[model samples]
Target: MRHRRITAALGAAALALGMVGAALAPAQAGGGHDDGPATSYTNPVTADFADTYADPAIIRGKDGWWYLYATSDPLVEGGEFGLMHVARSRDMVDWEYRGTILDEGSAPSWATDTSFFWAPDIRYVDGQYVLYFTVTDTELNAGDDSAIGAATAPTPEGPWTPVAEPVVPPRPDGGGFFWTFDPSMLADDDGSRYLYYGSYYGGLWVTELDPSGLRAVGEATQVAINDKFEGAYVLKRDGYYYLMASSANCCAGPSTGYSVFAGRSESPRGPFVDHEGVSLLDTRPGGTQVLVQNGNRWIGAGHHTVVSDLSGQDWIYYHAIDREEPWLSEPGGINRRPTLLDRLDWVDGWPVTRAGAGPSEGSQTGPVAGSLLGLTVEDPAEGRALRGSYRPDVDEQSGDHALVRGRVWTDEAAPEEVHVELDLRTRRTEPFLVRVGRGSNRIEVEVNPGERELHVEYGHGRFQEETTVPIPEEYDLSVWTALQVHVVEGQVHARLSESRLGDVIAEVGLELRPGILRSAPVELRGTGAHVDNLSVNAAHEPVAEMVAEPVRGEVLVEESFDDAELDGWEWVREDPAARVEDGALVWPLTGADLVGAGGSGGLLLREAPAGDWMVETKLTLDLGDTEVRNYQQAGLIVHADDDTFLRLGHVAIWNTRQVEFGKEVNQDGFLSWGGHTSGPPADTTWLRIHHTTNDAGEHLYRSAFSTDGESWRWGATWTLPAGSDARVGLYTGGGAQPETEAVFDHVRFYDAG
Candidate 1:
């Protein structure tokens, strides 16, 4: 169900009075926006900016983008429940909604209609993204229907594939006293990962995972005990692992008593003790209180995660009820908790925040320092002034070059003529269009080197007049080119110049229509073109100028595996038979299979793909004289965590050689689905996997295979559950004979389309 506001519209007089009162109130200690004595910020960072977001789990992705994953709005009467929603940010302040991670129809069959997703925790590990989330069935009692599940994706934003079963399923048999929900993960320095979950009934529990982080390996240990506590998060600091959890009811809006408490232990799997030597296991005293409601207007601050800014300052992100807009707390209202952020300071051996004064309100300094404020434009000395919104893609090869990589439009009125220089690199043949106005009343100057022509046209609704000139043979299409367009009186002139030669390659003129208005904005549309310098001049006076600066923290990973060495990869199982030959990774028959006792073969990329990514590799499976077993597979695998993953394999199934797509969830047996079969033999198959999210935010995996590396045949498409951060690479196993060889001809990973 979508979140709905419940407040009644205030009268004009009442609204005016409320605004005047708010303006007259004294500023609190850290509530002023100015660089005053204290730094503070208002509550609900996304209040008026977006829909209500609660239970925020934020992470700085490997791609340098910040991601916020939260529980979707509950289903309304007769309405379908939405999937877990995700929002993205470049600087963590202004956010753009990326869509939900999963939708209704994407969940597994075991998850009944009564179940709803909640509180997701995401982590990037060993080149993959893993998500642990809570799910509860409304059909069962309060603490009886909650469970925890896991999912994986190749990138931070995913088409996540859920593990076939819940990581921690509900015990309908009443085997455990507490509900399994609100999951958080901790990765220790020694390559060990631990999951901390559970609610008030059985206290907060901790269990270790077997490297993959998909399956629990040992018995669960209770670390914190309290009548009203959940959302357990563990943070390791200064040789101590801190246990943080929310206490009291968290979803009751203004009347809620939710707060944050903390305990610490030397070990991640802890016997956590408070500052006063009080054990969290002792329900008689609970953990030490850290943050509580301090001021009016804001209440019930809880369910938090801590992150550090570029300046090395710790900030706690959480959600709280806003009293002024207590729409959710009104009579017969649903809980509406909006996200909030505040600084965390360390005091002695424990963590403290604003002297334990809960959440803050009003203006405050942000966690990060930089701002993306728009450029200031000055008026030109001509008819209608113009401004250019310069966007750049700075790389080592191009140094500092403005990118007209896609369509761009400006609000400034179109000028009669615009002058610009471009560094058109090779491998691109698309024409560049300098358009004025839009739709029917539009005119354009097109420079297409691929077609070797230059033209200028004026028209309405695709009806136009044009003058075209063929490009001179002396002009090199591989280098830079200078272009100009001028419209004066009732004529239009266009020109193009060769790189370094200054030779005019083409020139054209066209008759301009009468009553033409210079009112619409100017636009540039093209692909694979870079602008080194650009300027718009009006009446011979400069109106706009652009200079480029390098963009920071953009590239995550660019691997070719061309050196015939595993430079940025970790072998899941280092079989001595595997070697590099002719720039390809060759895994010889180790007599091992991918299932049962022989299911031990893997090689994972070391860095996780941040947002969306693709992995392509050419594989040749040599079965030798041994017959291909039912599952003798060799191809690519996309791992979410450790235990949950998807394999797009070239295998021998039922005496037929085919490309198969299978999934493994929580160590459950693989659910192999047949893909494109009856193609060419497996000796020279090019396998590729593309993982991305669609417009509706569903995680989609599109697998395809090629015979000659040029033409491809589409295989199967799989929809992942709500969460994903996946690792991708090549794998080979499950041969009937132990001695089978799988050869991979280079593995490539790139950002998805």
Candidate 2:
């Protein structure tokens, strides 16, 4: 059920022989160090459907529920089967894996013969629910034309019944074989239904569906035929029809690769060309826009589906090999492709990944499992006396070890470096190093200590053992560090952090095993180091904290905000023009408080908050010009602790005709209050905000605006670090049409969420 792997710090101790040979090696054998803790999408809001989903398709039903369908292992099986799984969610983030919804084994006679059922798309047509999918021949890779079938049900998850025979038949072209597969359907304004289907082979082809919404109306027309295409999607945007498809090889795990391509045409059928003027049918690399690439942590990314949100934002979902997992044994090893999903932003009508920006820090923010991979600890646990063993005869409970103050230890030298080679199944992000003690001194493998200070070390090892190489002390890391191990010459390294430096750790005279000694033996001495917030690289951005206190170590705030003493901080008016009473900053809006004709004003200070901190403020606004000043705002200044900070508060004015209901305010000048609004504001509103760093290099500035101060909602999330010297202050400046003052109250800052 829950598959896991151990940290791969020493496994690379073995050569890249076949999987079996590496598996049998002793002491850091089997390229074991090459496997590191697996990092998935970490943002809870964006990570959904955390399962081995393939050929993913999502459709929103009229009932407001979004249904997700995937073509393989819907019920969590180890082997491949022609079964489609189902999942549902109201918000795209939290998906409830609903097991199997459709299976081919129980299919109608016409479909039972097919084994490979793939790319299922659901649509609602004429008060009826339609499911379109492709079923391949039992030969699998024989590449013969497959049949497109139709099924219908009232609900999204269906005990579906077949509507009829193949909706689209095999190709009539004379290319030896017409492989029909991966079908998607879209309805046009004139009541015409179109189906787009194709494989990674020939190209994407389109056909008209009969009014009954089953079978082809006539001969299928070749629409877009790019050789690098597969998993095609058709949707209409701004009156123009678009076909989105993935190009290149896919389903190959870490090596699996492809790029999303797009083509536009007036009609859903006929000659479709990419933006580069290349024919859709031609297999070319440069013909399509590269939406994603492989490098650093992400080796392969492609095979995607795009979905639009309530705000018109489109999201892209695809599968990629979790590079942290090594290549599977031969054919099956490279086939475990993990699904990856990210939000897509449209720049000039062209889709691009908002999170994927090459292999750089702050390029992506993914989700993680709700719980750790069976490992338990606090936010900042240390690694001391932590020993792991891979003994063939040891049991799980027996070999398990605990990290103390961040170190592991052993009385005598073990045959291997700690127990790194024992349990290769557990994956951990906690930094661990082999440490062995030798009387007066100890040795270490320079594992990341999670601090910015220089860590002492010796030697780095590649999987190849031709020669044991040494590394200079001064190891630094962030989110981009790859798994690495250090080897000592001569004596087999013992202890979790102990290593025989041949001439360094006592003249290479120690026996490799425990309870044994050699006059000139080498010993692996030193314990593993485990620290909190240890990223792969050393340059990742920090997490957002309501307040930052370098004096209290790193801002490791994972919960609420409270401080015994508000030390090293000052309470200055967020709005300079506003008055301060009872030691609380307040803004009182008046005619003079309003910016003059075409002018602007609010408040500012000279200095700002340093490190990772967040600020929030409450405000009220009453204004005129209900039409022109609707989105007015008042809020806090982030990045800046003082005058020269970035402010996202309201812009509405004061004293204008208005309407009121409950907490809703309708007026002109100095209207609505709170953060991140552009036009005007409502009357008497309170805006509170939070701005801070994202420790995992999630560079984006995270801020939430709230109406009731206690209940916050996400407003705008962006990346404008502004280099750290930024301060916080209030500012209300907009609309030269007329001016009104906005009021402010209740401002505060804290260390974390």
Candidate 3:
């Protein structure tokens, strides 16, 4: 039995840092497993080097140090500022300032007296360092000019020389110039280069860059829409290219709602969409939120760069404003955006910061900060379980690697991250597999040469739909290929290389639920073809911790639904089908919603307790198992009006069932609505909305949800204008199928706990 990446019937699917810093691999990937060193780290990553460094870009220098660059800002309060800042670190935590890249003495000739540089993007191209940046205004043009410029450097800390002109000159838009900022460079598998740049005013775009990586060569294609996102960063993982951009107001003192979101496509030039398959260019744009404020002191977390530590773990470097000390000088002066770092985890094929914990406010385990793991097969091929007609070992060509004819499996361990690396003969029609679990719980990979694709399947006992990643055309399967698969806690990432130290030709990934691969075994299964150079390694399992939100204050106004008579509550639009029944409020779901187009759905509202108070609701609504239920929700809502309010509910959007805490406000001439999702739902979900006014008198609403009704996960915060009499109550709407209804047990208000 040639056990595939999974069972023959199904398929399955997948950190560290380095100290020579794995500069040998692409910036976003693992080099070879070269054990270097390990160290712990924490953030404000640049607190020791600078007071405010925003819109960061990072790269691993050839010298083995991780180099970081940031937007022009004062390094200290009321201190002299620089055009752009640079720093270097070995552990990715402790950093040393290497001084500014540009200043009065080193300013380019094309830069005007008032012009300045910002958002430095550093890349290693054609044996030298290439730097792309934003020029606020140039000597060649006037009237609101902002464009991207390029420079070349011999090293990370540079004596940089400017290119002839702006790589992407500012274009006129509505009497002014479109924002051409936040430059990021990419080199595709085909050897073509690209530059992504733009801002909230013009949208993010990707233009073909010349081989020099210093100039744009073709018309641009919009990847993200304007007025919603900016600060674009792109990453190629598995087989998809991800567009990660920041949304909301990036800077607004303590009120900043800035956050990060992501979309993905298979090509470098993308028709990208969020996790729900919603296009990024839609009027009601879709974005999978990746980073946000989790009720911590850190707010406005955005503009990030992604990197891998020596230990092969993925980490994101971003900037965040400390809510308590957001500004450096006067109130609402310059936002003190200290650099922060957090682990980036992939769940459901989408990226989320800190496994949905958001920004880190306390201490955290840092990167392994070390090289690529290498596995070797013994001459006698020891430990391999030979199944059926499989032979133990033989001299295939010059190496004495395992010659696989029938089937075999090897290497089992406890539930932890597992890394397997080996060389395989590719051209053969027979399939090869890398299994990371035993029994039913495991990830399986199938290398189908005929289809030129990798079929992946995963499960606890059963399995999921197979994900197919097409092989890159550049890959020549006739020769030996190095296959590296990393089975982390909840993700399976695999890449195929030309040789043991060759370029990665194709990559693919599959995300599984956590703990699926318990203390299991890593096995290699093959049919017909023989293999060699097999090695396996697993990390020491990590201890998991849970953070719970405390219940604020005593229960002030507890509304236990026990009778038909409801007191102190009024209906916005009465639904005849809804009534108090049994021991709960049994409200039949209505096929209606209250958003952009206005309200038709009924709402139950009650006067909110004065001062600061917390409101919570326990509800049960069967939206069925993961199915498309567009916005069908039932829970608590604090309504000021039909058009302006805040809602917390157990809602279904596409296949994802989550607790959505959303805010809708009538701004300008239309409605603006957005939300943040919290804890994964259960049969009985507990939703809470905390209310507190800031020093500016703005009413702040933060949400929390619990699956077990105890261990709560506090999520993002949304704000409302001060002095608004927002009533708090419950309702069920946005869906009107006869199959679903909400049973609300009670609505409780607590004073400050």
State which candidate has the highest TM-score.
Answer: 3
| Ranked by lDDT, top first | 3, 1, 2
TM-score of each: 0.44, 0.41, 0.59
How many steric overlaps are in each model, in order? Answer: 19, 119, 44
Off by over 4 Å in 1: 1-41, 49-51, 74-80, 138-144, 172-177, 327-332, 369-753
Q: What's model 3's TM-score? A: 0.59
lDDT of 2 by residue, 1-753 (tens): 111100011122222110110011111211012222323233222234433566677765433445777764322224444367777765555678776656654454465454556677776554446778776652323445577877887667766877557887655456645667778776553446678887644557888887657778877777654334677776554334667776545543332334566666657784556454444643222123424442334434555665533212245666544434523342332234445556554333434455224212232333221111122212212242223331122212212222233323332332222212210111233444434334323334333233321123332232111122222222122211212122222222221110000001000112122322222112222232212211110011111112121221233222111332323334443334555444444444432222213223444432433554555556665544334453344455543322123345544322222111001111122121111111112354444334445544433344444445553433333333325455455555444344455555544555543
Model 1 error, position 429 (Å): 40
26 in model 1: Cα distance from truth in Å? 28
- lDDT, residue 265, candidate 3: 90
Task: Order the numbered candidates by TM-score, best leading.
Answer: 3, 1, 2
Model 2 earns a TM-score of 0.41
Candidate 1: tens digits of C-alpha lDDT, residues 194-280? 888987555688888766678887787878763435888786543467888876556533334466778888788778887656566
Give the alpha-carbon lDDT of every model. 0.56, 0.41, 0.68
Task: State the local distance difference test value for candidate 3.
Answer: 0.68
Query: Which of 2 and 3 is ahead in TM-score?
Result: 3
